[model samples]
Target: MTTYLNSLDYARYLDETDELRHFRAEFLVPERDGQPLTYLCGNSLGLQPRRARQALERELMSWQQRGVEGWFEGDAPWLSYHRSCQEPLARLVGARPAEVCPMNNLTVNLHLMLTTFYRPTGTRTKILTLAGDFPSDQYALETHVRSRGLDPAEVLVEVPLRAGEFHWREADLLQVLDQQADTLALVVMSGLHYYNGQVLPMQALAQKARALGIPVGFDLAHAVGNVPLHLHHWDVDFAVWCSYKYLNAGPGGVAGLFVHEKHHKAQAPRLAGWWGYDEARRFEMTQGFVPMPGAAGWQLSTPAILPLAVHRAALGLFEEAGGMERLREKSLRLTGYLEFLLQDINQRYGAPITLMTPPRAEERGCQLSWLVRAEGKVLFDYLGQRGIVGDWREPNCIRLAPAPLYNTFEEVWRVGEALDTFYAASRPRYPF
Candidate 1:
């Protein structure tokens, strides 16, 4: 309900009074021509935490100084290295520590969850998902269906957006779930749409699926740190996420998985590995795999210590910032300011752009996706040339997400200023 102004002074005033403003210094912002860039692409790849380097160095020292003993002798032992990330991750995604584990990348975890949950018994063989989902999730569903001797065309039930709409409606999505409930064995979807930045109604969807006896999961790559979640209360069966995006865990860093406590004791089929065996008896090199009781049982290999160090350091910042509740408050204001500026620009320049992200604060996170009416690429490039960093998707979408941890209100104002300059200059040439 705060009124936003287009002036730089107002932006600076907001930043000065901001409670989480100190967090901006914790990250290493990207620069162009020796000056800091107006970085607003955390949804694509987060800014590097200043502590990440030191965290990696600590792990390197453990290896250099302890050699073989490093596994047992360090302050944080290598054997339980992945355990360091569990609690913080749980807090971020809303689950118990035992329900979450840092492991392989996003797709690998997705396949594993699908394998365990997609028990398509006779007649109930379909997997419900969002149409135009991130390609990785789509591909994972397709190949997993094929591996199970089912036709993806028949087994994958996709809920499409209504014609000419940029996002899905909750009622429409729930209606499809109700219609397909009889045949659905699983409902796996993105917690937030990557392209349009819409936060789907996860709680409602999960409640409906549980009522219908269909197991549900989420690919929370875009939602994990960007939005608030309560997976346990929602009764989500399982979920997967990558830390490289909003987590700021460096590129290709260790990813995470969650399995609700209810499923921890289920006699489900899993693709097991040595690391997933009972920690107490793991070194026994036994004949059978006695998996760990919780989500940790999903692990596949020796923990990647270096990447985990970086992840631990990055997750620590969230804990220090008082978790997602505090961050979400700031994100609401940051994105709201950007929306206000864009609306002002559209009105002044004859509506040259349209916002694809939902206008309601509860329906989105930090991102605002704009659909440029003309020369989207040119406008995207113009922003880049001015040292403003945002990402462009094909056709006409440009996504700008200001991380509450590092981005300032003044930075959001600069984006508005730059866009105004571009559209004002283009008005004469493009007849806007």
Candidate 2:
């Protein structure tokens, strides 16, 4: 239990002692009015890594020097380019390298994984998810269900948060799983939820689903690189994630997927292409589709080398910063400090704001969601004016995530400072 103080000196002391402090230099933080902004929105999109440009340019040079030969000639040949992303990603998600693959974007990978994993048979014709999930995941599930000729309303089971609650309870989730286990064909949900910044009890959920003979998967868009995951050990059947958010691979960067080794030999239905063919015989260009073993077998089209290059470069920083364990160690304190400051401001100002994210460090990663009454947009704009970058979800939630890799303790403190100033200045407007 670390005691937090609402003081700039203490924030700097925390930053100074942080083992991952120097990793901040590896990224290009955005600036406002000739000064670096306190970026706290890595949960939405991570800052570009300094080496990303060089990585992309190297691929560009290869394309310029060798047109058609670029696929087979370079030191990091385009033919096997996506492989460079696997080891680092494997470490982040806690899967065997063979189980992870960097390929299509998030939704595409979700659809692909769904096509293979969401096998509805007889009475077990349902997909279980959470209410208020990110829009993309919701759409994917609905569309996939409809594609299977099943009514989405009947096929999709959502475990709703209890009335007047912001976060879902683990017990409630487990109970729902137990009740729906007999009919569930698949269990797919976010590992770390997007709207409320809640870290779902994935291990428990997976264990329960496994015991009940239901296939389980996760959308790790908000979880991967934000928290430490053990997908393989948790017995998660499949998972998908985007790189732009926490991976810092730039916008629309190539995404990744994980297919448990147990499913490798299963005769599951897949939307396959030539890239997924047996690598040694890919050049043979024969008719039959024989997918390579492991997650690489999920590939469809030729990988976009430029994004893969950027992905590799961004992942390198994780290796240099000593991986998720060290990054998550700093994340708990950094986000914890921000939570403390927000609580103090709300307490002093008559509680004009509400925190939607779970209070426990174990129930979240780095992001914290705040509900600022009707003045949510006002507070969002105020923070923008002070060069504090965060996200505002429609209706009334502001999300601020101080990434452990590039963000500092001082940045989190500055957000608190800005919020404190806003609350103090606007106290007269509220009728407390």
Please give the distance, in angstroms, between residue 37's alpha carbon in candidate 1 and its true position after superposition: 0.6
Per-residue lDDT, model 1, residue 159, is 93
C-alpha lDDT of residue 291 in model 1: 90
Question: Against the hidden reference, what TM-scores do the models get?
Answer: 0.99, 0.98
Clashing residue pairs, candidate 1? none
Q: Distance (Å) between predicted and true CA of 235, model 1? A: 0.3
lDDT (Cα, 0-100) at 340 in candidate 1: 95
lDDT of the candidates, in the order given = 0.94, 0.92
For candidate 1, lDDT tens digit of each residue in 51-151? 99999999899999999789989699999888888899999999999999999999999999998999999889999999999999999999999999999
Which of the numbered candidates is closest to the native, going by highest TM-score? 1
Per-residue lDDT for 1-432 in model 2, tens only? 989999999999998888888888988989877899999999988999999999999999999999989999979999999888899999999999999999999999999999998888989998889988999999999988898889999999999889999999999999999998889999999999999999999999999999999999999999999999999999999999999989999999999999999999976789999999999999999998999999999999999999999999999998988899988998998899998998888788888779999998899999999898758898899999999999999898899999998899899889889988987788788765
Regions of model 1 farther than 4 Å from truth = none
